[model samples]
Target: MTAQHGHTADRATTAPPVTTAAAARDYARSVVRQRWDSASRTAREEDVVDLLLVVSELVTNAIRHGDGLAAFEVALAEDGVRLTVHDNSDAVPDVAYGRGELPSGGHGQGYGWPLIIRLAREVVIEPRPGGGKSISVLVPLHARP
Candidate 1:
């Protein structure tokens, strides 16, 4: 699903819930000023939109593949925004660049990470400190058109 990232004219605000992926991402659209504001502070509409989508996809993957015990968190820093999805599953996600063509599939399921790579500045899927895996994406604050 394509999402529209809207930046409000008001100052920064901490979104409630921050519980589920959908909730957290939906709140991101409303965060305008950001937590750390400086001369270099900035936020892009496209970047936020893509970031939310990535978070949603990763959360879905975790909930679907991982055990019931799972939690996700989002942080907005000066350099960029971070999204962490923690799940009980230790298996890391496989990156698919999709340089070639897809031979079609049942139910027409494909094309998620590939879009993510194209959207986000950096995407990293690594294991957490103790257990499970965390998918972190860094969306640059100073993105250009």
Candidate 2:
């Protein structure tokens, strides 16, 4: 899957398969953090934290709930970051938690979608041309003070 952010040309990279959601989340976090940090010196710490949070939640959801992760991408736009995670399931996520709730998980509770919507400038879920689905979120990269 590709994340279109209208900045530098989108480059696709494959993350090696990992067993657990935690592993997937960690790998994705590190990859994006490194890339984004290198790509934009002006990106704020808060913005990178938000970017990582969104990355963790989305990739974790794909690993835990969707039919496993298919691919992941982080796109750096002129003004923001775009994150996309692809999985084998076609299910569209529902926002369960209120906007104010913290996104950390609980027993049989969903916090990712709501937190994503609350944090991201925009969120989109679209069906893959072949099969499955992709969830993408765009986050503004605010300049550090």
Candidate 3:
């Protein structure tokens, strides 16, 4: 959410408010790269890709499904990156809150939630204080060999 550990107060760490999925992805990539570049080891390419996918899916869902993107935050952790996406809807996806099963029937939909569940850890969906929901996840990043 807000800057922590006295890190530099910049968009790279907190990100300016974004509306499109592409903008969110760009912001997330910058955050990941900035954090990993300054760390002891580099993040694996595949892991970064996974993180980007998750970022896109979440932001896209918020804008497309949820009313609209309310707030977006990305923070770096010791072993992974933390994402908190807020939307202007209170409805939480059944797949995300109920069972972590991928939708069976092919409908061109319901794939993003499953992909998010598969790639992210500590996934949480909670209703916001006002009238929306916040989805948070930790996407783990491994060091390159």
Candidate 4:
């Protein structure tokens, strides 16, 4: 990502796309590190973990239900980190609950979205203008600070 207008923005890492679940989480982690690594150097470690975990969950979901692998953008705005993942899936997510065990492959199972709603400042999904889906998740810098 080039330094534009003195601000670091989320850049599209590549074209084509990543199709594997493992590759998706790895890509998400890379974006988190590139964006949060800077100011996080002075912030608490827990905050960093929270952001990375959230990113992993969102990215994994996109890869699984959507078409092929997608892309994630992590931007360090003045207020907090803005994480957006774009996928080719048309499925919109909803809340579901059960008593079974968590899925071994997915990021979180057994109704883990509420955990995200509790941890993240904001979680939203909207239909992309063209043909896909986009999920935007905002995580605060620190819960205490």
Highest TM-score: which candidate?
3
Candidate 3 local Cα displacement, residue 124, angstroms:
1.1
Q: List the residue pairs that clash in candidate 1.
A: none
User: Per-residue lDDT for 16-114 in model 4, tens only?
Assistant: 265554555566456545544454243355766676677666666776766633566665554457777888887776542223244566566434555
Task: Report residue 141 deviation for candidate 3 (angstroms).
Answer: 0.2
Candidate 3 colliding pairs, count: 0
Model 2, 27-61: lDDT tens digits are 65565456544533556777777777787888878
TM-score of each: 0.62, 0.71, 0.85, 0.63
Provide the overall lDDT of each model, using Cα atoms, as 2-decimal numbers.
0.56, 0.68, 0.80, 0.58
Per-residue CA lDDT of model 3 for 1-117, tens digit only, reads 432334433332556979888898899888777655454577788998999999999999999889999989987776778888999999887678444466667753477987898
Q: Model 2, residue 67: displacement in angstroms?
A: 1.1
- Candidate 4: regions farther than 4 A off: 1-41, 96-109, 143-145
Q: 37-143, model 1: which lDDT tens digit per residue?
A: 33444456666667778767666676776653266555655555666566788876455333323336643335566665665655666777788876666555544
Error of 2 at 86 (Å): 0.3
Evaluated against the true structure, the overall lDDT of model 1 is 0.56
C-alpha RMSD values across all candidates: 7.6, 4.9, 4.1, 6.0
In model 1, the worst 10-residue window by lDDT is 1-10
Error of 1 at 33 (Å): 4.6
Clashes of each: 0, 0, 0, 1
